[model samples]
Target: MATPMLTSPLTPRLTRRQLMRSALAGSTAFAVMPRPGAQGLTGPAYEVSAWTGPVSGFALVDTTGKTWRPADLRGRAVLLNFWASWCEPCRAEMPTLQQVADLYGPDKLLVLAINFKEPAARAIQFAKTTGVTMPVLLDVDGRAARQWGVKVFPTTLTIDSRGRPRQRVQGEVDWTSSAADKLITGLIQA
Candidate 1:
């Protein structure tokens, strides 16, 4: 007989206290600076309506070997960040991302750090070295990176609860800025 593999739920259930902590952390980080623009981060603004492609509901493995999917993020705002261990700018912006994840609360907003073409071991090492707490997903083949049109390192694509890409910030950004919190909070409410 073949062994069965139990599939995990799309969204993990988190307690109110945990949610509050994450939100507080994110807010405090955003208070430190202003939100930077997305110029030079990606190719172009992907048409909102054109988001009907295969990129929807994609899944990737996190640092802990758990699977993360877009479907799991349905009710929350999401920031899908494509990065790599070797990118200098990517390394520079990790703290802001950590703050953003803490501020938004996992229940209301999920930040998925998708590693482009990097080994899982390297990704894990990077996380430990940088103290990044956001879930880091591995894109070993760079398929997701190519699909999402990530032309540069540290491109951030903010997706609303409906899974539509709202803003594409290319290049490094101060993830903890008030503008970023306002935008994320607005999206969560929207």
Candidate 2:
């Protein structure tokens, strides 16, 4: 008679410790991946695919308690940024974002910083502390962040006159760099 073959369990199970270790390993690996399109920045780089349609729209109240809509920004180049006060990288990138806003002027380019999942008071404080002069929209519920797929802070989406995302910058970016300026300028001309 042939020996009976011992079969393993149908489902493989992981111990709690093993699961934790695996999760940590996966996160570490993601963190170590090189940020390819960072240009001069020192962080993970991600390629921004061209935006196709209107994408998703979000409503955020400004400091003045007025609602701001994405449609209001049509027919103009816009920098749609998702940030938070607790994020160090977001804080670090604000000055450069401000510089970019200054470079383009409000008429030609609109820099809209949407504070993700933060209270209006906190967002206002952050803007005041950072000296960020651009319009800071409060996404109190993080609706816009989720819509924009913002998994990381300091994510910037550059929208053209037609409300399409032309470029996306993830992580921290030197917004005042010539490369950055050139990219924005090219978007404006497009």
Candidate 3:
């Protein structure tokens, strides 16, 4: 008897332009900023760029088994932080994110820590251990990250109250800093 083979599910193929764009997005994920005075901002060790690609909507369940969707969060600015427990930068910046979440309150700003390809248990445990109180959504299959074009760890996408993507910040920065305040303030005021 011959051995049987298993086939995987069919998925859409990417075009040449899409491939190149993914390559470019990954390559330039980390944009270095010039020293303080040049940009007139000080001590923000991260890059901010306009959001690209389409992120019309997403539905992901959090550790508490609550399904969160963009539609449910209308009339509020959202900070979607793509992260994993293993990433050092992600871990380092989480506390500040928590503080920002606390300061802003859910009515105005909703900070969601979307755990990339991590189990719900791990995400919950990490949140408990780190004292991070924000909602931690699980992206177990990594489809959300790919959909959002987040090729880098610790990438943050800011969505305005009107549900438009405003900016994508790659890398870590002290979220409690003045620069971060300005950024978040703008989003809240939007």
List model 2 lDDT by residue over 96-165, tens digit each: 8899888778878888898888778888888888788899988888777777766666777788766677
Of 2 and 3, the candidate ranking higher by TM-score: 3
TM-score of each: 0.69, 0.73, 0.78
lDDT of each residue in 11-44, candidate 1, tens digit only: 2333343334334323221222222235412222
lDDT of 2: 0.69
Runs of candidate 1 with Cα error greater than 4 angstroms are: 1-57
Lowest-sum lDDT 10-residue window in model 3:
3-12
Which is the winner by TM-score between candidate 1 and candidate 2? 2
Backbone clash total for model 2 is 2
How are the candidates ranked when ordered by lDDT, highest leading?
3, 2, 1
Clashes of each: 8, 2, 0
Segments of candidate 3 deviating more than 4 angstroms: 1-42
Which parts of model 2 are misplaced by more than 4 Å? Answer: 1-48, 53-56
lDDT of 3 by residue, 100-151 (tens): 9999898899999999998788999999999999999999999999998888
Q: What is candidate 1's local distance difference test score? A: 0.67
**Alpha-carbon RMSD, each predicted model:** 17.7, 11.7, 12.5
